[model samples]
Target: MADVRIIGLDIAKSVFQLHGVDDAGATVLQKRLTRARLLPFFEKLPPCLIGVEACATSHFWARELTKLGHEVKLMPAQYVKPYVKRQKNDMADAEAIAEAVTRPSMRFVGPKSPDEQSAMMLHKVRLMLTRQLIMITNATRAHMAEFGLIAPVGRGGVDRLLAIIDDQTDERIPAQARSCLQMLVAQLRLVKLQILDNDRQVLTLARSTELGRRLMEVPGIGPLVASALVACVPDPSMFRCGRNMAAWLGLVPKQNSSGGKERLGSITKAGNRYLRQMLFAGAMAVIRRAMQGTRRTWLIRLLERRKPKVAAMALANKNARIAWAMMMSGEGYREPMAIAA
Candidate 1:
């Protein structure tokens, strides 16, 4: 235990696999422990670097281990995958984590605090509720269309749908059918109210933080985007630069270069999908306004040569970079001076 300098922990609900190595990179320990005994084992061992693949419970474990005086680092699961020797079981995965954590260039994910995690949970719940509402709304509309009752496009269209449910006098929909759909309508109303309540809470929380205010100052980052980013990312400094943050959100293009020839395709579209979508949607809003306004700068020039959607993505990449800078410097976003292309 005294010689163990690194421990790779592959965590599960009931069982955990651990692989430990000494300072000279020699395997010193490979062990499994039940949930009850895991913490006590760590509590008894000497302080060392503990590496875990980031997952649902990794943050909780990382927080717990940190309090016990052990230095804990988290690496992404994808980055650790290449090091798996042969078989892909718990022990082999733990060993891979052990090896990957020692690499000089390996990137680590910062452990999120309880409050930060809670805030992220709020955004996720809101997203889920919003999605459910859309699904129900669409399904209700489709079903009503079958009865020859159609509503116009847009959100206001739902009102006609609800109206049909309320109108028992309308012969188009049978009473039994109306009763069945009214239940769904009730559910739809309930979800909308829940979403509204969540939005209010998130807005209040966003106002409580200086970081959130600064984040909102960036073009296209509304209260929702600002709040979501603030909650999801505890430390912007984890990224070396703005571009790195954007890349982490997968806003950058995918590359395929061979024989010194560079080939770039669509954006990677990896990492935080919510953040990527929010940033891109925000960019679309910005581009829409830019088109109407008199600002004929970089974005306008880019739009002249590229498609609108392409311009939106480029703007999203730039805004992500800007947001990263703002978070790091504790400053509001300032439009950069455009240089000759």
Candidate 2:
């Protein structure tokens, strides 16, 4: 135990597998500990390097281990996958983590703070609520349509349906169907209120931090996007450049190059799917406004040559790079006109 220099911990709900090695990369200990015994075991162990996969409760464990004076490195599970031997089990995974962490070229994920984790949770819940809102709205619309109560597709249509439900004398909708639809209407109202509250919370979070404020200065980023970025990227310095950030967001094209021949495919769509979606939505919002305005910004020019969706992607990628640069430099966004001048 005293000789253990590097420890790889495979964490789970109750049991954890640990693989410990010495400075020369020789195994010194292999053990399993329960959830209750984990901290006590680490408490007695000497301060050393610990490797953990960046998965479900990884950040919490990393923080806990760091408090014990052990240097903790969180490696992305995908990056550690290559190090695993044929047989896959807790022991093998632990060993692979130990070996991978020792490599100088290995990439690592920085452990997020509790606040960052909380912010991410908030955003996820908001998204789930938003999806529920859509489900309720669609269900209500379909139910009403069966009774021949169709209206134009939009908020106005939904409003007309609700008004029909509210009218006591409306015989078009059967009593049973009307009762069930009232339940849906109640749910839709509740979800919309919840979504509004979440939006308020997101806006407050964005306005409360200097970093978030700076991020919002970018053209396509608003409260939700800015706040999500702050939570998702706790350490922007991990990226070497703005393009690296964009690539991390999976905005760049997939590459298949060999023998000096390069082939690029569609965007990898690899990183945080939620963030990528938010960026695309924001870019589309900007493109919509640009298409209507007289301004000839770069985005407008791109829209002229490419399809709107493709142009939106290009704008999203550009916005990601710009956001990364701003975060890295502690600088606010600058307009293209200002930069040109």
Candidate 3:
């Protein structure tokens, strides 16, 4: 009712709860609205600061609220948790959101655009399908091994098995067993086809986007990585620096400090799991090729001393930092200096 200074919205699928505070931090309004009524209610309110927990559908509302002349801040759910008082309820959560948004040091999630969210959803679906395909392939191989049939270990093995099943002269395999293998082979083929199609779609989308095109210049970043980066990070400027970006990607080591002594552990492994996995895979690929070359660069030399897995992770960390620099500076990848001979 009074001049609204801040409004904390606890959003849900159908019902939404709002807690409003005035400029003096006194409670001004508390109301509930259905999903359909949410926007209309905000449109009537004078332009004020609105805060919401970063979750499903939050971005959509953030964009909508922004368009209605309200300043929107999306706080990560974890950051809001500390501010929650004794009992956790809609009101409490709303209050926590209000408190969290006001903190100067609070890190907020940049609201993603609809297209960015769509791209991310597509990547998630592709990842699920790829996992299913791997499970099916493994299951088929394990099942065949029980019947004295040894399938090869990789994709080539799947093709070989299918070829064997198709062969008329393969009398070694029982007729019924061959029939089952035939069915599995058909399914495997379909899964592979789907995977390829999804990959192509992702690649096409990445090539068409500006950010994706820029990300592609990085050695290990292919179409998938480029597109994933574009989908995951809505605003590159949100990261203060390259290191911040790397830390956000969970590529940096975790730190523990006590008595003025600092201890560092393995990477935090926080943030987008899919992007982290892709970066690690890319790192592995780069390491494999670098090993074959005679160039004794700093990274290559480091790889020689550390375990392959450790080296791979180190490269991933470096790549993450490089990615951040590229994204933030709007520049392409540049080769680092080599140690003087």
Candidate 1 residue lDDT tens string, 296-335: 8788999889998999999888888888888889877665
lDDT (tens digit, per residue) of candidate 2 on 218-254: 8789999999999999999998898988998899999
Error of 3 at 64 (Å): 1.9
Segments of candidate 1 deviating more than 4 angstroms: 336-341
Question: What CA RMSD would you report for each candidate?
Answer: 2.0, 1.4, 2.5
Worst 10 residues of 2 by lDDT: 295-304
Which residue segments of model 2 deviate by more than 4 Å? none
Give the local distance difference test score of model 3. Answer: 0.85
When 1 and 3 are scored with lDDT, the better candidate is: 1
In candidate 2, residue 266 scores what lDDT?
Answer: 90
Compared with the true structure, what per-residue lDDT tens digits does model 3 show for residues 121-194?
Answer: 87998898888888878877776777777866777787776677789798877898888877877888887898
TM-score of model 3 (CA atoms): 0.91
Q: Count the backbone clashes (under 3 Å) in each candidate.
A: 0, 0, 0
TM-score of 1: 0.96
lDDT against the true structure, each candidate:
0.91, 0.93, 0.85
